[model samples]
Target: MRERWRQGRAARRAHHRRRGLRARLTRMFALVAILAVVLTTVLTVGATFRVLAQFGPGVGADTAWDAATWQQVASGAGRSIIRSAVQAAFLSALLAIFVAGLVTRQLTRPLARLADGAERLRAGDRSVQLPIPPRQDELRDLTATFNDLTLSLARQEAWRRGLVADIAHDLRTPLAVLRSEIEAMQDGVQPLDGAALARLHGEVLLLARLVTDLRTLSLAESGALSLEPRLLDAEEALRGLAEAYSVRAVEAGVTLTVHASSPLPLHVDSDRLRQALGNILDNALRYAAPGPVKLSAWADGEGTHLSIRDDGPGFRPDDLARAFERFYRADASRTRDPQGRASSGLGLAIARALVEAQGGRLAARNHPEGGAEFTLTFPVPSGEPPSPQTRMVTRAPSSSR
Candidate 1:
């Protein structure tokens, strides 16, 4: 009963506030109209009195009455004029009140709709979209903005739902594996040997990796990730990464190479940069087997550019558009490797996040030469010049592999 009373009182207060807009507008319009009528009436009465004073017997006239007669005539005329003016003013005020009502109604209709839409939105209705007004005015602009706000809210809500579902799906697989392995050992169906324990450990590691990647992605996206940025040689970094991953490339029957036409300087977090590039390179080696993967770096007027290109089946149109969405795999075959190791599908998303957190942009496109290309661009810091050294480094696949 107390809750009901509270709600009722709140509703009453809201209604009271809502009524104020129309009341204030009506009062304002009526006040202006009444002031205009009164001013006109006053001017008309004053003009009549002035004319009477000028033309009556008191003034220089040829055939006028005596002063007392003139005074009486003026007084009677003044009374008649005053009566007509008062009657006209009364009628005008009534008309003004009626017009004020219509005007206020027209003005508050759109506002009322907007208020209702806002209330629905507050009530968890993400799809509430208000109709825009037809007239080109401030009200119409406000309505358009509100519609845009609703659209953005709907998109965010959808993304949130998708994120939760993806996380659950990714977690369920490794968890199932762990449960099954433990159950088998407990039932004496499988020996609790080194191989079995190793298998279980691998699944645990997968789970840990997924959780870590999710945390990193969240931090990067929320601008809460810590970074230690400094000036670094972009060309050298590319060469170093290429050398580090060359063995893996060769193991997969792929050739990994780095090419730099000139020295390129960049201001960035070295560790983060390596992390982003490593993710892309790993993807390239995984999918572009038996083909060539190339890393290139250069600097131009725009900024420093680092790109990884692979001579494999390029990305499909849909993949190119959503390659960075978390846990979005273009093909079901991409869900696991040939060795049966599951993919968390957050590699590209985390890479993009890390790059963007450092004020750089990452983009994916199908190379014109028939392969996939991922590029990273970073802005050059002020007062820093590119190295003048004109050198190039290239590493090729080992013939023994």
Candidate 2:
């Protein structure tokens, strides 16, 4: 019984294992052979009479085809005609074989690639780069579509990993605080009061801020961040940001200086412009020595630039390279705020997003003499973005904001 079942299964499998060409080619060759005989007979008869006419015209188109004469004509004509037809048919078959091989190979290349890709996909290999032919025809379009699917899948995988990490990190601190609060209350070690309530409030706020920043950054990167652009008073924007950061700087024992060329207006969103300055100011104040925080703005022909420099231990020479990556903190400056307080490391990343959404540019670098400088540049009020200068260097790929 088992042997019979196994045989049945094997037969079923064999049913789908297609014999692609042998059966079809055999039938086609049989049909060609029969057609060739009829064609040869017809042509031979016509040729014999015509050839016999050159021997004599007295048959008057009614020459009696006697057995001997007919047999002789048939034998001679059939041999010659059949031989030539055989040669011609062989040559045609050889040519057809070569042409069929070429066309079949060309047409099946894409199908072959599709098969290979399926095998790799079964093996879970996502980085395979199977390129499609670059013709403007249907094959090219199909290849392009496959490439897009591969890229989209890769991106989604990466996004999944990143989101998981971000979420875990985001949850860790807040959860730890909440746990500690509950433990303290349970043990009667600390009473729930104004101080405890405030701490809890702060932690919740921090958690909320992280969620908000993540959403904002995602929106900006996905091209969904909306902008409200207008003519910006660059001087006013700088002054407001400087004032906001001055108190924080003074508390940290750093002098704050805000300088602006009077009323330099720009084609920008006022709120986003202020956010850009605020981010620079916060970074400067956070890293500056207990000495000075300098914020300055000026217009240069077709564009305007704002600079914030701090005397504190500014960014290291290489730290400028990845300053705007979300959650990244410089190795030397990941501690507390100026007053020895904690901070979410998303400030610069959020600031960069806002700047980019408005089609502007921002970057950070080490000051020549000493310290760190963040420069945010925008096209001046001439209604178009300014062309970059010959010697000016770019550190980060800036946004259009």
Candidate 3:
């Protein structure tokens, strides 16, 4: 394998040597310079001879020139023409050299800076920012793209650090609970009763759930999450989910309703889609007010659209921006559910990832009237993408409600 890799690299280098950009440009400039010199010499010699031919005969005819006089005139004229051609060739060569030098300098400097920036980035420098080339050309575009890439990588690195911290924090609580309980029982400070055993079991469950969610997210992000896609009726899916969550909504004292403007078809991984929808529905039911939470479906030119909106206190402005971030909770200090159960905060993040893996988009926004709305747009195989046109609508809060 190593030998094959080395051979492939050598082949590529040889190919580049024959047709590299810099080499091609250098050859072009050399050809142009040589042609300029040749043309200048030819034109200068021809013009000089033409002038002598027209003037030399007048001198011979008017002066009764002898063979010696003719020889002197011809020799001087030839020397003059040769001198002029030499001077023209010399000037052309100088100009060509100067232009070639400028071209090489302009091309090589930017490329060197780009290479240096890449090296710095590889060495873990997130602050590397390449200056955009001034010329409005492909090189300028390349520089701009490099800057964008560096910025994106830096942001991803920061997010990764935050994820690690969040995961540690999430794991610490359950592990601490289990350790404390076991230690207490061992010290005879606490009895190993049903209550104590149940508490330990709950902590284990929480840890299991957190681990599973982390695994799912990792798989989705890495494109390792497999999907079994089928043609699904979008309207039916929405109705079914709304029905499934209705009981939870009732338990939470929130009204749940499903509305389908029209039937729409979609090709998707049903189980994955349901998992994503369940998370969204769970969030809506958890945070919504006693008013109605609507799940609606419709078809547009862009494909099928499903939205879940609640009349609850809308997301805090800051939370709205990063609600989909993994392990991100709005109330950071309040880490438990309303029932005081531990929460992983991976629901929306997982939902977004699963939806995206199946060629869909999941987004959240506050309803204009009052509340948060989560919209899932799934593109049909035969339909246009939702990016060009969106058909989700925001309704005003009813005064009567």
Per-residue CA lDDT of candidate 1, range 252-323, in tens?
A: 777777777455778899999999998898778767777888888877777788999999999988889998
TM-score of 1: 0.81
lDDT of each: 0.82, 0.68, 0.79
Candidate closest to the true structure, highest TM-score: 1
Alpha-carbon lDDT of model 2:
0.68
TM-score of model 2 vs. true structure:
0.64
Name the lDDT value of residue 140 in candidate 3. Answer: 65
Q: Sort every candidate by TM-score, greatest first.
A: 1, 3, 2
Per-residue lDDT tens digits for candidate 2, residues 205-304, read 7778778767877887777977778876666676666556655755766666666766666777787677667766666656665777677777776368
How close is each model in CA RMSD to the real structure? 10.1, 14.4, 9.4
Ranked by lDDT, the better of candidates 2 and 3 is: 3
Q: In model 2, which runs have C-alpha deviations exceeding 4 angstroms? A: 1-100, 103-107, 118-124, 130-160, 299-302, 331-335, 340-342, 381-401
On lDDT, the leading prediction is 1
Clashes of each: 0, 7, 0
- Of candidate 3, the 10-residue stretch with the lowest lDDT total is 392-401
